[model samples]
Target: MLTPVTDIDGAPFWEYAAQGELRVQACADCGELRFPPRPCCPHCQSFASEWRRMSGQGRVWSYSVPHPPLLPEYAARAPYNVVVVELADAPRIRLVGNLVRAAGDPLDSLDPRGVRIGQRVRVVFDPATGLPQWVLERA
Candidate 1:
């Protein structure tokens, strides 16, 4: 797996994930949560920020499956579904991740045919990458 690019602003998110937690950046003053952690808050333009832990529960908002002419690096992971998950804690904050059948399952392990919009899912950290992956809440 490719190591995620991390910077001063986003490092905390990965650090939290390394410890089996899912967190998002929030404006310390406004208390608004944001993904893709950045130095300044978009809502209030505040440099003061913090990481907020999430419930890790969400609903599938949308999804996509790449077809023919797959990239060499992803050809083997073909037939996988990339889902946009709307966080239960912050409906406005959506995340992109693979919708797997179970925790630790390969990206392509879940049958795309079985995935449905609004399906409930929870976060699971990959042991190797510490990157959060999504699994059906009740697989």
Candidate 2:
């Protein structure tokens, strides 16, 4: 159970996650997509924006296995993976999410030896929570 900071700007992202979708901020003025869900697009500085759903597919741009939990809340889940994934649909945008599977189901468990930089992955919604998360996509 990861706890996220939901603020005015980022609330919609989490809300969409609750609905099993990843919604990014797309600037109505320039059609450029942005992450972290801000009010204005950095490219055009336009306040006009809309929510765009992603394909939920991506590749591991970068990854790390925490020897110790970076946050107190994750102390119990130490040695977990945190990956920066470049979404397939949104080529220029990347997202950060937990690589996990359902309880009692060992599907795509994070392996230190198996995971490498640039591995292909896809978004997987946690069946229990119905939240949009990520998992390794088997080739």
Candidate 3:
């Protein structure tokens, strides 16, 4: 269940992730960027869309360390950091991911206590999973 579930609308996002590129859908008709890759643009309701590349640099907008009784699949990785990152290229487009010491590192590898809001981070794709993970820019 941890694997991303892809549909026609979201397939491009996952496809880009697999290629180690961070991209978000944009309204082809109006040039408005959007996340969660949908068919219709929330800005203009246009069905035409395109995927725009992102800088993969962002600030830690928020984060949390979940307690027990979480999803059974993720319970073993307790005390992990789940962060919402506000993209430097698109402030309104935020992505959720883990803050790791390095690309491909385990979700809980970094101590949750070390994470904080407004910290600078860069995106790194997990070699095995291709999922986007965050790492402290200073580190």
Candidate 4:
């Protein structure tokens, strides 16, 4: 039962997700896209930023399956996947999220065994959390 902690820089991300849109922060100065939103751009140190909608397409860059000793809330969902996805629009911008069966599905809905690095996935907003998740793209 993880919840997003909204901050000055990341609030807009949650706001957009609530509207079913996937957006990332881009530096207004250098036009560099970044994730895990922050007040200043790492590349240009710019305080000015804008939210840019993404194509909702990316590939799994890396993943992990948590084992035991997990928090009680997450222990029941053991073997769940946590993936880092590299956005197709901005390869350098990566977002961490779970792989779900569909929009609004639970984080552990998909079997961990099915997740693979480099697998293409699309973004989906979870209505319950007003946050983004991922779903494998079909051929």
What TM-score fits each model? 0.94, 0.82, 0.94, 0.94
Where does candidate 2 have its weakest 10-residue lDDT segment? 101-110
* CA RMSD of each candidate after superposition: 1.3, 3.0, 1.4, 1.2
Top candidate (lDDT): 3
Across 41-135, the per-residue lDDT of candidate 2 in tens digits comes to: 99989999988988788888887777763577666566677788899999789887666653223323655456677877888766555455677
lDDT of 3 by residue, 9-45 (tens): 9998989999999999999999999987888999999
Cand. 4 Cα-lDDT: 0.90
Clashing pairs in 4: none
Mind giving the per-residue lDDT tens digits that candidate 1 earns over 22-133? Answer: 8999999999898878989999999999888999999999999876578787888887899999999999999998988665678888888888899999999888888788
Candidate 3 runs further than 4 Å off: none
State model 1's lDDT: 0.88
In candidate 4, what are the lDDT values of residues 1-139, reduced to their tens digit? 5568998888999899889898999999999888889999999898999999999999999999997688888887787999999999989889999999998887679999999999999999877787789999998
lDDT of each: 0.88, 0.74, 0.92, 0.90
Model 3's number of clashes is 0
Q: CA shift at 44, candidate 4, in angstroms?
A: 2.6
Ranking by lDDT: 3, 4, 1, 2
- Evaluated at residue 126, the lDDT of candidate 1 is 80
